[model samples]
Target: MAKILVVDDDSATRLLLKRDLKLEGHEVELAKDGEEGLESAIAFKPALIICDWVMPNLDGVEVCRRIKSDADLFATFFILLTSKVDLDDRVQGLDAGADDFLSKPVDPAELLARVRAGLRLYQSQLQLSESNRQLSKTLRDLQKTQAQLIQSEKMSSLGQMVAGIAHEINNPVTFIDGNLSHGAKYLDELINFLHHYQKYYPHPVPEMQELAEEIELEYLMKDFPKLLHSMKRGAERIREIVLSLRNFSRLDEAQMKAVDIHEGIDNTVSILQHRLGGIELMKEYREFPRVECYPAEMNQVFLHILNNAIDAVRQIHEDTGQIAIRTFPRHDGWVEIRISDNGVGIPRGLVSKVFNPFFTTKPVGAGKGLGLTISYQIVVEKHGGKLECVSQLGEGTELAIAIPIRQHRPPHSPSDSTPDR
Candidate 1:
């Protein structure tokens, strides 16, 4: 509906005009005079303006002139209605940016028709403006999706390469551990043989004793087992690292099943524990309800959000900071997961744009700024729930994900809601 602002000095005129516009199903606001009109115009930002031409202290002509002069306000249509009908008066009103003029002793029919005409023009402008806005938003979302697709492909390739590299390293590391284990056994046997020899002979000949001393047999026999144990330990560490890398690159199979939210959080934390080594963690997990979800995708969501909170804490706090994670059931029958960190919080202005993909304050290579954005899509768009955050600069940030205990369809299936479509 069009919002029409009526500006005139006469109280009777303002009331009648406002009442008439309202009866026609338009939202009507009034201003006492040109001065009040100017203030109302900026504040209300009406779609159309119906202004009287003559008034004291800021006349309608001056109001029109100022509105026309301001580039930002020039798009507003101004209709001037006044008693002035001389050629010079008409010229002056037109020059002052009145889109149309209506001479006074107004006919109610003609007034409504002219107002209708202005409303139509205003509506046309609104439709065109809305179309432009939608188009621009669509373009931005398309670009972000394209970038995500490319990144996903790159990650897939990297995962494959990582698995192969881990496999290669695992082979040699396994052999090294096996060889050290076997060598340690052989040394044990050799030591027993020497003991038996000593027991059987009771006494060694002078030359044999000298030869054993020269070889440093005693020292080698004592330290060799410990040295072998150390080597085995080192090999075992390599084996564990190789295993972790393999797990990290495991393919994500799309499967919808009941998943434990707590378990997913545990796995996510375990995977990122190394990254969190420098930060202190405080967890308050309430008993949670399992929900139907794609386990792998859900895991990814946790990873993205948790990683972001960790990064934020690291950035803001020079000293070790705290990360608090909590989970509980909400009254809405949704499970609420909150991940909070005391670190450099988001600026007030940027809080609104955090989920705009690729919008990041991190250094160029530090981040791609898609973590929170992807998480938001997963919780809200994918699972039919909400993702929200409370943050203050220099204080900290809290990211909350509330997903239904049972899956929710958003008037349709979540999988069916494709961004491109």
Candidate 2:
């Protein structure tokens, strides 16, 4: 059924039209004048409008012109009702966007025929609009999928390369670490032998004494051990870096495991060392059990939140910026990690849109804007976690990430294998 509005100053004409349209199974609304008719058309968005040509304050042609001018009302069918029979008058009404005209004495059959044709046209317009909306949605979905695929491939390649580098470095580091202990032992025995030889033959030959002094033998004995110890420390630090790299690239481990949460967070920070040059990092960690999760995927999530926090603070304060990371256990099965920064914060109005796909505050070409979107899927979809942000504009931001100790392991997690930003 179609909704039609009839506007007329005459009470008899209005009632007559309403009564006849009702009998024909069309819903009809009565408007007393042109002004009231325009208001009703806007409020109800009727499919058709019939207005008297001569009404006080606003004429039917003026009403029709306004209706056609509005984009939202373009689908509405308008008809001009008048007793005027002049050819010029008909031309004027048509120019004002009137679809049909009715004589003042109004034939019921002609009115019904015009209403039927107008309703058919309105239905066709609605169907076409719906099709356009669907097409737009499809296009957006395709773009999102293509972008995600590209991101996933890039991360996968990076992970494989990192894993390879870590493997190569690990072999050499292991060789150096394994030899440092024995090397120190040999240096100590040689030193002790020389010391004993000096004690037994306190009076050495003149040539030997000259040689010892030339070589700074006493200082060499003390400093050589210290030098070896320093080398040992350096080797240990290299080993730590290799381990961090291996853990970060966790591509080799496809299955879930109970892993150290603090270590994962540390690995992510270790990889971002270059960008964290001047910022201060403060960590407050509680003694908690290792979490059961997908190590590679969860590492990416930590990277996203922490990286964003670092970026937020680095904007205003170069050397003075601070980022604090805190972790604690909840009474429930969940554990919470909060990354906070004392830098430029997000605006309140835009905070809710942070997780939307392709939404970024950064300028064009600076970022892909997919970091939080991918993070949201990994934490909430794959691991059954909660991620939320609290921020005050111009002050700072804090993002809370909470994940359960264990998960049900969702079946379809397309975005969990990669890093995105």
Per-prediction TM-score: 0.66, 0.72
Model 2, runs deviating above 4 Å: 2-19, 26-125, 256-259, 286-292, 328-335, 346-359, 363-365, 384-393, 402-406, 409-421
lDDT of 1: 0.80
Tens-place lDDT digits, model 1, residues 1-421 = 6888999988888888887778888888899999899989888888789899889998999999998887667778899989987999989998998888876766777878998887687678778988998999999889679657855776568667867898999999988988887898898999999889988996799999899899998898888888888888899877877765665555543545566778677766766778987799888989866776666566667787788878888886654899999999888888888989888888899998888888886667998877777777777877887888889998888888888887755566655453310
Per-model tally of clashing residue pairs: 1, 0
Top candidate when judged by TM-score against the true structure: 2
Give the alpha carbon lDDT tens digit for every residue of 79-119 in model 2: 89999999999999999999888887989999888888888
- 10 residues in a row with least lDDT, candidate 2: 412-421
In candidate 1, residue 413 scores what lDDT? 65
Residue-level lDDT for 348 in candidate 2: 95
